[model samples]
Structure formats: structure tokens, C-alpha cells
Target: MNDQTKGIIAWIIIGLIAGLVASLIVGGAGSIIGWLIAGLIGSVVGGFLAQRFDIKLNLGNPFFEQVIVSIVGAIIVLIIAQIIT
Candidate 1:
């Protein structure tokens, strides 16, 4: 696989983890597609919020850090969704 392919796979893995964890924390219908969507969008929002807020998680492993950040972001997304719908 190429570098881009590897990166996409990594993101999917991280997103799955984050989405599952976030859903459990926030209460959501657990589904593969739901998790993927939440995780992907959460990753972007979380990365942006973290940068804007100067929040850096020193989780040692970069992948773990990404998952945690994504989870947090997903939680926020889920909460906003609940409010909207």
C-alpha cells in the first residue's frame, strides 16, 4: 500500500475507536456507519478545536492521542446533534 492508503487506513481505525468510545459515553445507536461518520467528522473538529484551544494530550503514543482527541470531538458532535434533533 502507498503512504496515502496507509494514512487513510490509520484514520479509519482511529475513527472507529473514537466513535465507539464516544457513543458509549454519550449514548447513541451503535452502528458501523454511524461510528465511521462520527469519528471522521469528530477527528476534523477535534483537531481544529485542540489547535484553537491549545489542548495537547501527552498520551505518549501518537495514535492513542489521536483516538482520544477524536473521541472528545465526537462526543461534542453527538451532543450538538441531540440538541438539534
Candidate 2:
């Protein structure tokens, strides 16, 4: 797949994983679809945070960057979810 396709898939996977993890940590009030949305948003937040912190995996592609970004994004989402609920 092309970089964009890979990136999209990567974000979806990351979103699902991150959402699941968040649900596990926080408990309930979440679904796969919700997590998916959270994950996508998280990636954007993660990217912003990563850029601010100068953190990068340097895998030489947006995919790696997105992966890193998603992890951060997941964490942010988790925290927000925890706080909101």
C-alpha cells in the first residue's frame, strides 16, 4: 500500500488498540467505534505534542511518525476520558 493508505490503516489499528487499552485502564463507557474516533483524534494530539517535545522515531516515513503520534494521542485520550467521566 501507499504511504497514505498505510498511515490510515495504522491510525485505525492504533486507535482500536489505544481505545481498548484506555477502556481497560478506565473501565466501561467505551466502544470500538468510540475508541476508533478517539484514536484518530489522539494521533493528531500526539503529533502536536511530539513535535513540541521534539520526539520522533525517525523511521523515515509518516507511518512511523503517526505510530508514535498515535501512542501519545492514546495517552491523551485516556487521560481526557478519565477526567471527563
Candidate 3:
């Protein structure tokens, strides 16, 4: 697949996983769909936040950086969702 496609898949996976993790940490019901949504939203928010913080996301082989971004993004999403819910 292309880079964009790969990125989408990556985000979905990350979102799903992050959601589950966040929900567990927050002691809430586990919803894959919800997690996926949060993950997707988190991806966007995280990307923007990272950029604003001068933290660069690698489009290449830097896997760790991406993971960090995903986790941070997931955390942000969880926080927002907590407030909204």
C-alpha cells in the first residue's frame, strides 16, 4: 500500500489500542469503536500538539517517535473525552 494508506492503518491500530489502554487506566467500559474514534481524533490533535511543541514526527524510520506521539495523543484524547462525558 501507499504511505497514506499505511498511515491510516497505523492510526486506526494505534487508536484502537490507545483507547483500550486509556479506558482501562480510567476504569471505564471498553468500546473498540469509541477507542477507534478517540485514536483518530487523538492522532490529529497529537500531531498538531507535537508540532506546536517543536516535537517533530518522523515520516520515515523513526518508530519510537511515532509511538510517543501516539501515546501522548491518546492521553490527550482520553482527557478530553473524560471532560466531555
Best by TM-score: 1
lDDT of 2 by residue, 1-85 (tens): 8999986786688777666665565564387887787777777788788889988687888665675577567767778877887
Candidate 3 residue 12 Cα shift, in angstroms, is 1.5
Alpha-carbon lDDT, every model: 0.90, 0.72, 0.70
Show the colliding residue pairs in model 2: 42-73
Residue 71 alpha-carbon offset, candidate 1, angstroms: 0.3
| Candidate 3, residue 1: how far the Cα is off, in Å | 3.7
Arrange candidates by lDDT, descending: 1, 2, 3
Q: Could you estimate the TM-score for every candidate? A: 0.95, 0.65, 0.71
Give lDDT tens digits, candidate 1, residues 28-81.
838988988888889999999999999989979989888888999999988888
Which candidate achieves the best lDDT against the true structure?
Answer: 1
Q: How many steric clashes does model 3 contain?
A: 0
Which runs in model 2 stand beyond 4 Å of their true positions?
A: 1-3, 57-68
Model 3 lDDT at residue 20: 68
How many residue pairs in model 2 have overlapping backbones? Answer: 1
